[model samples]
Target: MKIRLWLIMAIMLAAIVLAATGCGATTGPSTIVTSQQNTGVWVSGQGKVTAVPDVAILTLGVQVQESSVAQAQSEAAAAMNAVTKALGDKGVAGKDIQTQRFTIYPIMRWDESKLQEVLVGYRVENSITAKIRKVDDTGSVIDAVVTAGGNFTVINGLSFTIDDPTDLLGQARELAMKDARNKASQLASEGGVKLGAPLYINESGGFIPIIQVPIARPGIGTPPS
Candidate 1:
């Protein structure tokens, strides 16, 4: 009788242990499954917009070649000085006129017969960058530079820019966000999914300078409208 009682106790203990083990396993797996089901899907979208430039910058220079370095440099300097003076006379501030490039290089004459090189003359170049706050005066400034002994070959043309791009960039970002949301909504509708609040938002776009045709002039003329 005692043996049978001990055997019954052992069976009950085994049953209890098995039940506890099954409960622990089920609880952990259920928690993990719930977490996975609650996870959301990620979607992405992009957009772009055009903005008109508000400022114009022009680069102008004078290049002169002469028999000697001194002569070439002197001529280039005089021409550049005349150009700057003309700009100042036309209400360009001293701060706005900046010297961008000044170079003096030897003009090499290659001799094929002797396999030698000779310095025939020297070439001097001086370039100045002018930030014209008034876009209307860009053409006029070029004309003025030409009239002020700025020879034809050295006049590099104008480049357009935005003086303050901060406001425009902000507007662009807002537009981009709107575009992304619209795209997401359309996609969700097509896929038969409810559009949820954005789990993540990533915005990326930049302003690029639009280039205009460079005007070439043998001599100065009326500003382009």
Candidate 2:
């Protein structure tokens, strides 16, 4: 009877030890699964597409100098009026004409004889931006401004851009996605693991307008940023 009781106790202790060992084995696999779920590959890609621009934006202005502020302002207004009329005559819409800046400031010059700075004159500047729909007529519009404002007229900047870039953007996005997938695949292969399905995707870039303005002449203007 005592032998039987001892055998039963030994069996129960072995079963308890086996249960503890089994629990520890299960925990290791659970930790590994949690780590895998929290980790993933990250990468970025870039794409570019070139297409002919269909629109032009022009920044032109009038600057006048005079002995008094009132005189300078008057001269600037007259020049700007003529410039607007010229633009209207060339088919530019009123809504397309935007006033970018208008200012009147005094100019100072160093009087070497007096050894001090002195007020010389006042200067007035008025800047206007015009969006030209007919790209081919850009040269003629520039000529019109020059004829109206003469030496006071300054072409500050010009830029060309694609009015509708939907197709180009789609193509660029596809290329970027492919680039990312390729990089991820290469990394997975080198690491001796099969690439899993992508758990997340994000777009990092969008269309950037072209700024190169094909000027008909050297004095047209520089491109804006």
Candidate 3:
């Protein structure tokens, strides 16, 4: 069986009621209510829906250290090149693989005799983020990169998400609207006032839900998730 992540979401909804005592007026998120309306009712509703994740994003990189910056960078470059090749061979499209970070810095060590920090070596770090459309192949894709990079491979992060949430969002939106209207109807019944159509709809936008699987950096050659 393959690993799967659940995407949970909430949609925002508001129902506006026009008061009969007030003259016709218009404001944000509410339609114009005329003097015939007796009361303004504002209510919020939420909708929750679950979706199965179909996409995986992996953040991995190569880190190497040597006596000089050139040596360190050369080795890192070679390793990164091999890693990218492996990714391509594993069906990852070239466009989906992107470099996220590339850094070169000096390594330091404490020296008692010098009474200061001594320059030990230089390190090169090259990281990339890969978007895997096939969720089931994520583990295999990671394995390929690790094998290609050898000991310099480091896994920074991994997460799962939905590719297209339009359908799910539509479902949530319907549920939310229904919830809002129901609440408004109940309020009107209690207040003994006529219920009116929604004057305003507020949309707060949406975000992709993520499931992060924590994994430690075990270096290349070690098994990856």
Candidate 4:
């Protein structure tokens, strides 16, 4: 009877140990309780605007070729000097007129049939780049250069630019932000979610050039209105 009692006590102790160990084991992941918080929507947007150009840039040059390098260089220099004087006479500041390129290169000729190479006369080119703050005078300036012995053949077309781009870029950024907000709101409404504040914002600079339009005047009938 005593042995039987001892066995029974041992069995009870083992059962208690198993129960304790089972309770100490790790539990499963806790449940994530979601409330009435709305889901966020993402969006991207772009904006563009046009503004008139306030400045003009002109590139003018003279090219001369002669049998001797010195002669070629002298002719190019003389033409460029005349161009500079013309610009000065027109009230263009010395700071605005800048020499952009001055080069002297040997002309080359090759005969494909005979496989012969020949060195022709040297060609010298001198160019100047000028920025004019007054856009209205751009055409007149080109005319002056041509009349002042500057080879009009070397005159490239004019390019237009804006004097200040900061204000324009700021306007573009504001428009971009507004567009982004509208897009986000629209997406949220369609997806049955809520729109939140922007997580990020980015912007880029913008500029548009003015293009000249050519018009021909024939016998006018109602001016083609």
Among the numbered candidates, top TM-score falls to 3
lDDT of 2 by residue, 1-225 (tens): 011100000000010000112122321231233344434555666556666666778888888888788877787888889999999999999998999998888778888999999887888889999888787788888899888887678788877777678887777766766676777667656655555455445565566674754443323211111
Q: Judge candidate 4 against the unseen true structure and give its global Cα lDDT, from 0 to 1.
A: 0.57
Candidate 3 lDDT over 1-225, as tens digits, reads: 287678787677654353322323443344444642334677777777888888899999999888788888888999999999999998999999999999998888878999999887888899999999889999898889888898999989999988788888888888887887788778767877665456656765465578898877855432111
User: What is the lDDT of every predicted structure here?
Assistant: 0.58, 0.66, 0.78, 0.57
Question: Model 1: per-residue lDDT, tens digit, 56-91?
Answer: 677778877777888777777787788888888877
Distance from true location, Cα of 162 in model 4, Å: 0.8
- The residue pairs found clashing in candidate 2 are none
Model 1 stretches astray by more than 4 angstroms = 1-52, 111-115, 217-225
- lDDT comparing candidate 2 with the true structure: 0.66
Give stretches of model 3 more than 4 Å off: 14-38, 220-225
Clash totals for all candidate models:
0, 0, 10, 0
Please report, as a residue range, the 10-residue window in candidate 3 with the lowest summed lDDT: 19-28
Clashing pairs in 4: none
- Candidate 1, position 202, lDDT: 45
Q: Rank the candidates by lDDT, best first.
A: 3, 2, 1, 4
Clashing pairs in 1: none
lDDT of 4 by residue, 1-225 (tens): 011100000000010000011223422223212331122334565556566666677777777777778987777777778877887787678999988888988877785777997666788877788777777776677677766744422675466666676776666666666676676666656655554334334344345544432322112011000
Count of clashes in candidate 1:
0
Question: Which TM-score value belongs to model 2?
Answer: 0.70
